[model samples]
Target chain A: MKRVTLFVGHYGSGKSNLAVNYALMLRSCGKPAALADMDIVNPYFRSADSARELEDAGVRVIALPFANTNVDLPALPSAIYGLVESRSEYAVLDVGGDDRGALALGRFVPYILEENDYEVLYVVNFYRPLTGNANDALEVMREIETAAGIRCTGIVNDSNLGGETAPSDIEATVPLARELAALSGLPLVFTAYDARLPRPDVPGPFPLTLQRRPV
Target chain B: MGNKVLMKGNEAIAEAAIRSGCRHYLGYPITPQTELAAYMAKRMPKIGGVFLQAESEIAAINMVYGVAATGRRVMTSSSSPGISLKQEGISYIAGSDLPCLIVNVQRGGPGLGGIQPSQSDYFQATKGGGHGDYHLIVVAPSSVQEMAQLTGLAFDLAEKYRMPAMLLADGTVGQMMEPVELPDEKDVEFTEKDWAVTGTKMQRPHHIVNSLYLVPDELERKNFERFERYRRIQETEARYESFLMDDAEICVVAFGIAARVSKNAVLAARAEGLKVGMIRPITLWPFPSQALKEAADRVKGFVSVELSMGQMIEDIKLAISCRKPVELVNRAGGMIMSPDEVLAGIRKMNGGDNQ
Candidate 1:
């Protein structure tokens, strides 16, 4: 089964960064990766905005005909169906920010879940709303599942995007992630480098898988 | 045996959450929803559960984030204004795919509109309360008993999908009292969280949970995958209740309290010998358009009866594909239309259609 990775987050929560980085990592590892831009929510930060950058890196960018709109983006291209058919090494889907973008999740659930095996990694930023706590985060997961009709496969605590983020913020959020893991029944998948961060004095047998990426 | 109790919609949700194995409750008090917070606060500590009245809606949702991260069932309740405050948080939660329940005892909105029974927030709850490209498992309850049942389902669905689920009740549903037999607490498998960061503890690996992705291409991938899940939701989870729709010549499309009122209107219209029926959307987010489409094929026309000024009418029109005339019966800004008033609209439409 081809490994399809989906990068999801709220607006300005750093979903795009992770999607791009992961795609790059996959390509550099000599794996062919296809990146599809399906974010009809926020048109500004879409992967199509940096189409050249992805193309330069040798990743196939699935482009939409018109600029994305909040209410009225054209139905997602049929190419998405073709790509899922390809069964590439990694197919990256960069979703829009928040629940409204989740509406777009409606268009694709049938094709993807039935066709290609996909991993939905709900990335969280502790500083972000809804995800700042364990309980609320679980609610977010449920909403997505109800809206998208697919169960969450994993969780990514890529809690920072820019300046002013501290290791303590990550420390403070660890327990929340533990609870999220227990609730969703999925493992907490994270970067291996995070182990160097100052550990919290919390207890856990967190279901986590470490992914080592080139920084 | 758990205690059987009669309670208001708001209080029943509080009681039902406790019965459903939810031990954590966090929320700030808002009008019409104040009772729910009070009930949770009163009951949480007694049962060794946790309840905190946060300083603001943002704080409350963030606290929900904190507790949900622990992999426990939890919930928050608010009226329109407070729900507005929590929208940012709701979006973040949707983005991160967290499982929690959000109860909205809706009041008039577009900014602190009113304290009366209103369904004005129907669009917000069913559409998207938060700023992200996301959707809540928005369930609009028609009765106080349903308020209890849906709240428990909200928690179950929330955990099931790893997404936010909302129990949408109007002020009427929240405040109205009714007899209810809350379900027995059965052992539910809160499984599938082998991926959550309960804590590394030197066991497997360090885990991170976030909605932030700085890469453009990667974000696109994520959004598309979320779309995949939404499609599945549309296919399997869309729910609505149809009353006398199969053989009726005319249909009323409504939800929540409006559906209840429309039921009376449909019956009265039938008494007057007008073939009328109703389609009530229980899952407002999924918006049982398919049912309406099927109904539209049978009915000559449709009337979208809502508490707001035609908010849901657009959906009815779209669903019917404009095959026939779509009329609207609505009252806005906390005013509710009586069954007689709704019947009048149906009569007028029928009167015109027949000629």
Candidate 2:
């Protein structure tokens, strides 16, 4: 697993949900995991909104001061810097959705780039209108990378229909995920699924406990 | 024209705007409606159109005003709070009688409420949101296909009436995916505006697009003329859909996402030998009062199902004129009213002897 995993995707693509689940997944494997909630664009369904659950699971959570508040300011808490610099086994950055949201990630590009051990995972949900197809997903990936000043190292197929997700839904997106992987020249690292659902045949299928609902 | 593509409601609205000859889109990023702006940003440049991300919602609506004054089919979209910020500009557009499209993918709010889908903005959208004696031609779409179709209709109505039109959608419709048969790109001919601010190259008098009138009488005349246009709109442009109302004893009135839920509940109630039906108001500003008044004579009672705490109920009562009792089935603050909850409400109304 990459030490520093940055999860980026469009809104309602389940990035924050997966980020929170991934943090707990890492800790369950005995790896010290810390999560940085860099999503200042969306006020709901963010990793910061699930900070209590994540912290209860023994995972460190870093969130903005005004997170989950009605104050829609884009002020990132300074604690994010300290969280990133600490000697944790794994650090997950739950980025905001889309290019405009990814602008917040630009400030940490220098530190992230200097580390040289970070991986940006572009979470793709075939259900989302903007990233529904391979071409659209690729376009969104390019836009996010351009805005964040970083290259996406892999794709995480997080295709879902919120709580209505079925196994067919997971199976249906495998081909699009593969096409997106080929078009973007990035690896399909994993397919995010509910842990309670029957896993598909795809390799590296990451089962996640559904923590957050779609915003 | 037969191609069906799965699409989100927000993206469908954007594509429909493009196909309807909208060349200018200015908006700020807000959840539940951001996909519309993002879709426009990607496709507008390819089509040689302008998609500008403004500094704020206030700026975006003002930009719409500028683009509308140029006689171009332009649009701006935002969620509830952002739409609140654009009220001043919306009023200005209304006063100037400029045609434009504004989409509100509504979230919960009295303040910066939760980002979940809600019908709390019905009063704001149907009633004048901005401070003025004005009315936005409000179209409420119930599905993804309607999201696209009503967008085309919104532009057509806006241009036809020489007034602003609003596509009032909730977060559920904005985010949900459904197969939609998109409209073909047509060569839409906009109504030639003799009052547009196109530069006068010595062919005619200079056209000025301003809302200000220092004289009280002139301002009153403008208001009267605008109200006259609104009267025409109310006369001819009211739109609504009736489902299973012929033999329905209990009629549920709703619009947008709430109507979608009400349809399911109505069907489920009918399955158990209860007579339930739905009246979906497609045009909220015109209110569909005539249809409701006609339905009130036939149906036993009315039940209003909405995502807000009874905002549309007052209009329902006013439309029916207290001839029938109107019950409310709603969940406020971003909580969706489930079909089961609506079904229970239907049963409660069905068991009552008040009707």
Candidate 3:
């Protein structure tokens, strides 16, 4: 695993859920992980919305001061800069949903490049309207890369039918995920599935617990 | 016309707006409504139209005001919280009588509520959210296809009435996917904007677009004129869809996504030998009060089914003047009422014991 992993995807693509799961996975493996909620676009379903749960699991959560609050300002806290610069074992930046959301990532590109050990994975959920097909998914990826001033290193198939996801759903997305990887010239890093479901025999089937929204 | 393509409700609204001759769209990102902006970002530039990701919802609606002032069809969309921010601007548009479309893909809210679908904004949409004696022609679309069809109709109504029209939707309707046959591009001829601020160039008296009147009498006159327009709208523009209401003894009053669920419950009740039908108010502002009142006369009782805490029930009662008991079948704070729950409500209203 890379030291810094940035997750970016379209809205409703389950990027925030995957980011929380990835942070927990890293911490469970005895890594000092920190998940930064850099999503300023979406006001809900963000990693910051689950900050309490993540912190309870021993993951350092870096979120904006106004996150999950009534204030809708796009204000990022200064602590996020320091968190990004810190030498944590693993840092996950749960970025906002689309190119507009990924614009925040441009601010940390310099520090991320200085680290030289970061990976930006363009997460895709084929079930979403815009990213359902390979071409549209690639289009979304290119748009995000252009907006964030960074290219994605790999593709993560984090596709699922919300709480209704089954093992068959995970297996069915493998071919589409491979096609997306091949067309975008990005490696298929992992296929994320519900941890409770039976694991699929696909490459890098990462298991993730369903992260419920904080009350 | 395009072939039926599977599209999210948000994307369909965007495409439909483009086909309806909307040349300008300004919006800030908000979940359940962000896809509309994203879709516009991709297609607007290609079609030589303007798609601006404004600094905030306040800025986006103000941009709509600017674009609408020039007699161009323009729109802005947001979810609940964002819609609240745009209320002041929407009021300004209505007071000025500038034609524009504002879409609210509502989520739960009193403050920063959850991002799940909710119909809690019925009062906000139909009752003039911002401060003023004004009204927005509110249209509620239930299905993904209606999300497209109603968008075009929203632009038309806004233009026809010279008032802001809102396409009030919920998160479920905005996020869900369904096959939609997109409307063909309109061969529109630019309407004569004698009242527009497109610069007179010393040809005629410069048209000023202003929603202000310092004199109390002038302001009163403006309000009176606006109210007369609304009265006309109430008479001619109130739209609704009646499902199985020919012999309905129990009527379910609902709209938007809640109506979709209520339809299922209504059908289930009919299967169980209950004469339950549905009245879906498509135009929420010039609400179908007359139609609902007519239905109330025939039905034994009424059930207002919604994703909110019975916000629309008040309207139903007011429409019928409490002739029949109106029961609420609802779930608030983003919790959807299952068809079974609605069926139970219908059963209870049908003189059966409550579940």
The whole-model C-alpha lDDT of candidate 1 against the native structure comes to 0.74
TM-score of the B chain in model 2? Answer: 0.97
The most accurate candidate by TM-score is: 2
Per residue, candidate 1 scores C-alpha lDDT tens digits across B184-289 of 7656445537657587779787656678888989878878888788778877888888898767999888888888888998999999889998888888877788
Residue B2 of candidate 2: its Cα lDDT?
20
User: Between the candidate structures 1 and 3, which one is better when assessed by lDDT?
Assistant: 3
Evaluate every candidate with DockQ and list the scores. 0.01, 0.14, 0.09
* Candidate 3 per-residue lDDT over residues B191-300, each given as its tens digit: 76989888888999988889889999999999999999999999999999999999999999999988988999999999999998999999998999999889987999
Identify the leading candidate in terms of DockQ. Answer: 2
Model 3 iRMS: 8.0
State which candidate, 1 or 2, has the greater TM-score.
Answer: 2
Q: In terms of docking quality, how is candidate 1 classified?
A: incorrect
- Rate residue B153 of model 3 by lDDT: 94
Give candidate 3 misplaced runs (Cα > 4 Å).
A1-137, A144-215
lDDT of 3 by residue, A73-111 (tens): 778888778776876558999898788889998988999
What tens digits encode model 2's per-residue C-alpha lDDT throughout B1-355? 1245557788999999999999899999998798899889888999889999999999999999999998999999999999999999999999999999999999998898888898899888988999979999999999989999999999999989999999999988997766677899979666567988878889899888998999999999999999999999999999999899989999999999889888999999999899999999999988899999999998888999989988889999999999998889999988888788889889888974321
Candidate 2 DockQ vs. native? 0.14
